[model samples]
Target: MPHFFSHNFLLLAGLCCLLPGPQNTGASDLNKKRESTQCQNFAPTITNISLFLLQKAIHWPEHTNLVFSPVSIIAAFAMLSLGTKGNTHKQILNGMGFDLMKMPETKIHKCFQHLIHTFLQPNHQLHMTIGSSLFVHKNLKVESKFKKAAMELYNSETIPINFKDIQAAKTQINKHVMKGSYGHVLKVVGDLPIDTVLALVNFISFDGVQIGEFEAERLDKLEFQLDTGKVVTVPMVKRQGKFYLLKDNTLSSWVLMQPYVGNIMAFFILPDVGKMEELIQNLSHECLNSIHKRIKTRSSNLSFPKFTISTTYDLKKVMNTLGITQIFSNRADFSKAIRDEHVKLSKAMHKAVLGVEDKQWEELDFPDLHKNLLPDGPSVEFNRSFLVILKDITFNLPFLMGKIKDPKTK
Candidate 1:
């Protein structure tokens, strides 16, 4: 059955992208005037946090697929940190892969601003949206300093709501997040907890077409073995083209990379039998860099399963695990960001969705054997009518995954 494109699929399944037509104008160009030079050096810090968060999330059951944008999460925290002071500020920055004492806070905020403007704003190619909101009860007073920073720097919309009306507050926040993410994240605030005075929510949604799409005729049903040894049939796509490939004998894995329309790169890591667990266990920032440096581009037939996955994170727990405790505690100092002394961070929520597919460029066509000629030793000569069966390369089970986003214009 052909998958239908709809918002529900985007929110629940996190796959099956709706390719934007030539006239799609939803993306805005408000930030195009400013040069994004600051984000060049700043991107690595955000990327570091993404890797850290992914490593922590990898503990999920091996059988389950995972997807989240560290850029969205970091943008949310950066917006929150604009109002923090003393240890609270330092702790948040530290967890974000920065040295608060050495790095000026203003510089950090400016870099975040650059990142938001660079990625969130509309472009001719990538379809993406990132936004944040601060919900506070009407009774509490918010500091003008923090409010101005949030609006000007993060492009976030700060709304004052009555948190006392729990149901109303939830509905309002959910609606705002849905619009912010363009319907990718359905619910942001589930239930307002008792004594909750303030909530910070951030959302990111992205849908991009493959640079080369796989042919619908080549889609085949194949078996996928889960980590638990359960084999399931799934739709797999095939393409024979030149792509960046790396065989890491040291890690006993082969890495294949595919390009998306924008600057996104999907990496598929297939580990040798029984080595999947070990490869995942040893996955780290340094190891990834090492593997990236050794990759070589080559022509080969690639077959991969077409699947979709979505994930929601309770960022408070993830932050605490990363040594960001003061902000979520009573001791948190928000004197600079809020007028009310009693208000502290009560909830932090983030949701992300990603979709991937294959594209077949003209280069992917089966080579003409006679025109290209062949080696002499025991090699069979081929003509236009010669049929050559290719080996099947499948990604069924025990794999590691990573995505790199580098946005560019068409």
Candidate 2:
């Protein structure tokens, strides 16, 4: 398990909310138009933050297999900002790569509301759930306004608990997370600090079935080389078909786009030997846009590993690096959340889990000639470290991103 500190986890834990129903026919269209505009304005910010975190997370020590939900982290902090004041509020928004003057606070929340609602909608191909739970001290008096926004916008549940009873509080939090993630994430809080007054948790769960027409019997152990020049054997899935592919000489990387059953697209980026760092440094919003625009369909043979990866991060240090330090310091101001006393966030922890299904396909007998023949076109094999992004094509936003260094590593 790779451990790092960052503010993205809260967003994942709090990414889910109850789907809002239409009040009436007259207001539905107007509300949707407003939400569409907000989402269009908010999509780029989410992409920038997702890519930025992906770059920072890959550099963390022992992060051979990394996975996280950027949408969840953004939503969690957007809810937190509702309770913050002064510089604390500014830092949270600014750290998320949002411009206060252009977007403002209200618009930001509305945008998040729209984004979360989109994810909660029913999809036959994808099973996804996003939700948030706020465990606050029993004595703490939460402002009505903050509570209302957290519930309405983020669908966050604020449950008061006795902070003195640490074990009970911890159990309650873990239970909420477990239920939210459908038991994929068993425990999020092992221990709660003695002085802890509030614990904000967010979780997101995704299960996607591949829409690629690949023979399951093609699954076999293949060589996966690490950056250290060591190759290990692992189960690799093979597919041959027309795919949207790109070969960027400038970045020395091959980008392969794979679609799932839903409108979800997964972009697998395999850099040329030892070019991972350069690819990361050069990757930007515009570069990604160009890649999306320029990728052409071509017949190719592709092989990618089957693996499951999870990450837990302590976001205090990471937030500080992003210029969000006030929330963790003595000068912290959460006046809007709790007006009765001074409260500074002591700890911010985030954990995310993602799995690509490994199906068991029975072996089939085939002729020697058919087995030996290869598909016509370029052969791209992800038998090494690479980046994978799960994006929603509808909104053009990234929900999950990760760097897979070793398929065998859990």
Candidate 3:
């Protein structure tokens, strides 16, 4: 495009790029330009002409580059395609405690990476049914939600004055922030004495009111005794170092636009995935079956527990069958081992099928599946969602879970 019209523009642009010295239009400088004029005039022109020739060569319709332009090098090496965020949306959300399924379009190299990760994640094959599903949630609204969990564990939000001697709320926030990265820990989160980063985690994992109610309720549950040995983190409504709840953009503006406001009137149906099923069921269905209510999307679109768990569960189902067999094989040779552990396994299976495990629970870890979302290890977040753009939608992912390293037994 630039070649045809700007004979001098192309030359000038290249000269500006290549020029080593400072720009000065004084007589001294003009004399210097003239003295070195031959060398200066010749170099960039050769560069421009060579570039034009290379384009002309590749014009017969072959992706060939004899000399690497910055753009060409990036494309050829498959480097420019990956973003710096280091995790795809699915990878970020995977173990973050949510049942999410997101497959926004991405590059070809990146898709294969996601496939490998999906493969490595724990599956249902030899296992038949998942008793461990009880360990985890069907979805985010259940497991990660502090308020709802607190209410179920200890009813009521306003703490009974004497029931629990509460500690003055102590909040922990990491002030150092890296813009465009999840590196900085800005606020606290969760209703439990958990190491969970509350606000951001909830913003990612569960709904907002659930976050608020849970924090308030957890405060109520904390007996001063309970606060001593517990290493719990709480979510603050404010940004880092600030002492107030961050204002909701919609609400702040609605303060004026609202003709009348008892509360917002909206209907929302956040589809459930995983243990989130039970949590969703526990709540009044204002949107799913149908109800009138105020709908709150995540804190900010950025604060979503991203999990593009493949909706194409064709592979997942096949793998589940394999998991069942591997975990519970009784070929008679397993006499000693089966005799020892079969009791526990059977109990787990029975509990899972009967829905008792979800109630009488313990911890269970699934295969960690993250490295698969995109290649080059988590394409960066160029936009709000930290997504990479692609023209086609393919079923494959970027990689398979290369290996399953047992997470530490905390």
Candidate 4:
């Protein structure tokens, strides 16, 4: 039997545990009272509202690590002040706090139909959490000013005393996801709406993917260079209206980087950098070569999405940062399997395309395709802003796990 430590040791250990003391009974009482009260003013400030949400996200007794579900957080804010006065508002708030959000798309007010639909659109985890927080937090300030000014104007108007101004704030992402939606994500005008597409155009201004009457001559030269590996100067054609990538496999599709990052975070729920690279390599060596050989003998001119091959060294650097270490056992077998699958897929695709005409390709426009431009573009400019999100998740994952810090870092 070992001797116990003195009273001083017990007191010091207890102090370090952060357990609430008897002196702070009133603070606990206030929170306990808040649990029962339906006070509109409880989360009045951005700080308070954020703290309220953060407490649920980080400090909840369950899942002690810094694991916050972005979907939960965004849905929480989206539905937080939905209909404050009626049972609808209460329901919305309740829905936010719940684990799985069946977005009450039907019940949302008509004026906020877009907002309701926006909730249905898929959002990146970090984007959803941070953007929704900023969205509600900003509106808290705006509504504060607006509330003091317009009682008579509002009362005189036809609508009811519906102050549930579903804060109509738009981040860079909202432009694509909420613009022309039918299912959750709305459709948009053209590829120009995608950030990376715009960035690419700015980086390398070319005549549109399709050759028009005016662009016919310049496009001929460009096509020649692509085919023969000979340099040719191509002229610029000012696109009067928006142009979508005329139907072809999206060589530079945004699916490469983003979903990969999300999947790693989401534990490979969908494709990410590693898979995308393999797909790209396969497309270039097999698909592009096959297309290249076929088109050379064709009477009609050819068109495909232009892309550049980075050196193996450059590719290695990009892959490493994205955690793309090639596992020894799986890659070759996976590639072979993928190749076999693509072979079958290609045969089916070719059979399906037998009756289709060239114009059909041009008419193919993925209006709802929200192309991610991050990982597809040049590695030099892939913005590290998203690292903040991954970093936050990192620092918090340990806390969420309830692991003691090295005692030094803490």
Candidate 5:
């Protein structure tokens, strides 16, 4: 089993009250409009794909925290589906929650194209970058339609590489993944087969400062209870804000949502104690939609432990389990993508990293608290006493320790 490390930024605050501000309010309204417009008619499809992936991931042992971009994964598959033929194409579309017979091919492609274009729009407050690439072996000649769809619809670049040079090819692909993820992902492509004719790679990176940033001075070390009954100490942050909250009795869980600076928002679904398995078993699109509808804005006092987490998965098995088998088999047909030789997908891999840091401390250096907290002597002048100097700082018990970053800088 693969060991999974925490790669998600655990926001100290869960759901908080939306503060009143004309500028912020206007921005929020615009974001709402953009999101609604972008996801129209495609929301159900997106949610189904995302939920299926999440359900498969939840079964992975030792991974308590999970972070993978469903959009990135599905977009990669959608691009690949364009190159498939007959049943191979139908299977791919079906896995994506679309019936090829009912949905016109052009409409599906257009929806994905629009979604990608909208997601790539520049946002100063939140940084989200998505990249996709089609690496073909030098010997293979890609078809014009295939290349055009990849380049025009998915905005993916085509890189011609000599697969015989396995080391060089691996290094090149790994470097691209690293650069695409802004160094958060060190590697993705591992050992490449000698017959590797083509590789499809996708990357998604997200970084954003909390709108209601955490106070560095208020960070407290406290005990955190893990699902395994292990009590560990960790750095915790706290804040009070208006947040949408819902008590999901049917699912026996609680759902909380908090917005970021842009259209992106994070929803956390926490299961009731000892009911985690039930919650995971009950995961569905209907449950999520109901939670969204039931949630209402209210003042909430939230505190949470933070973590930076990374997860990697060999999706070949997962894809096969999802009934997308022919693509990886010897009988695979890719006549639309390439005509030079018989080539089939040999591997599918993905790696994602999530980092959350307190904005206040992430961009600042640790101060000399020992010297700053102490006075020159007990007889020091009262006018310039340590007590007066200490008034600005706060200290807590040495409970747990972890890395802290100043959030002021990117």
Candidate 6:
């Protein structure tokens, strides 16, 4: 079996913001609280976008695992909207679940600027990088204002490439994505169209270590039941410790919150036998907030599967489904981005990678509490399909959301 520790492991990557350290002064504390409040206010929009993608993913084949970064997609489109005008700009913002009347264009960009800056802050426990880049043809003249806004607001890079040389252009774009994602995603653009004038690329990479202990000797193969009644063997890591566990009767699922070394939490939702569809349908931003409020600390034995997953998406089609059709059509307007030429978005690509390893637990400084308390709590084995949401606890934002049908498949 291919384990998550392997070098080929590809996990979902998303935008991650660092939490501010403890402050002693009253003024600093007040600023920290304000930052937290701002993030909380902006979180619902991103979460709604993730839910829309998840609902669309249900139409995919049953065996196919789903993984994507809502934060990355939103940031990329938000950056693109900087150069867009008229209906194109409105469509992009509206499709992202933002109301322009309440939050104008300037406020929207400022919010993203704050997010990108906070996301790039130094954090030792969690290693993450997220960025967007625009690859324009060498002959094209991009407006200085658009370039300046993209750089100052979104921290995005604008690179000029000679599209006439298809292979070189592809390699150049791929290298940018590789560097931004810290080499997790090797290639994002496979081929460049002959008339490709501009390409927008977004990449995010996230690495977090476990906060609990998992003995290597305890790693064993266990039976994993699929949704279609098929059983498969998978590597399972077991540990008993204190965690936030919730049994939601409304959704017919058990929610387990696992904390990482940093201010990151992974929520594992296991539906009862065949209630995956019900859980998926009932899942929403409001529902998740409710779950967060109801979850309580308890002792439990957690048996989680070790796995890695990666996904690449054609964002043009994905955005189209969300009613963002002008950017890909001939009527597209990017006058703010390019000067004296009508340039529409030729290609939009996004890739994310994620890997979970049991070895990460070895680095944690947890005490041996499982030995004395293993028999006192319920055993929660993830022996079937489940949903995973990786959230940044400080901002109350879920960056990556995935459905794990089979660990072996990835």
Candidate 1 Cα lDDT to native: 0.53
Better model by TM-score, 2 or 6?
2
**Whole-model Cα lDDT per candidate?**
0.53, 0.72, 0.17, 0.20, 0.54, 0.70
Report the poorest 10 consecutive residues by lDDT, candidate 3.
7-16
lDDT of 1 by residue, 246-271 (tens): 77787676666555332344456666
Superposition error at 121 for model 1 (Å): 3.4
Q: TM-score of each candidate?
A: 0.73, 0.87, 0.15, 0.17, 0.74, 0.85
Residues forming the 10-long window of minimal summed lDDT in candidate 4: 345-354
Compared with the true structure, what per-residue lDDT tens digits does model 5 show for residues 195-298?
Answer: 67687777655554242332222445566555556656665544444456566798776565545443555555556666656766676656655665678865
Each model's backbone clash number: 7, 13, 62, 13, 20, 5
**Candidate 2 lDDT over residue span 1-410, tens digit each:** 32322221122242222122222222234775667665677778888888887778754545667777778877887788899888888889888988878877778888778767765555512556667788778877789888988898988888888878989878888787776665656667787778788888776766653425543236668999987789999887676666788998988999988775435677889999889888887877677768888888887777778776666777775566578888887677777877566777777766766666644432544334434435577878889898878777656788887788887877
Candidates ranked by lDDT, best first? 2, 6, 5, 1, 4, 3
Best model number under TM-score: 2
Which 10-residue span in candidate 6 carries the lowest summed lDDT?
2-11
Q: Please give the TM-score that candidate 4 achieves against the real structure.
A: 0.17
State residue 57's C-alpha deviation in candidate 6, in Å.
1.3
Q: Write the per-residue lDDT of candidate 6 for residues 1-410, one digit (tens) a residue.
A: 31211011011223322212222212224665576666576778778788888878765434367777887778788888888899998898999888777767787787777667655655512455566777777877889999999999988878898877889888888787766655556666677677776776655556643424433224557899877789999887667776688899998999987675335677889999889988888898898879888898877777788877666666666777788878777677777887767766645655555666656445555555534436677878889989988877666778788888888876
- Candidate no. 1 TM-score: 0.73
Flag regions of model 4 displaced more than 4 Å. 1-83, 98-266, 269-410
Q: For candidate 5, which ten residues in a row score worst on lDDT?
A: 385-394
Residue 272 in candidate 1 has what lDDT?
64
* Lowest lDDT block of 10, candidate 2: 3-12
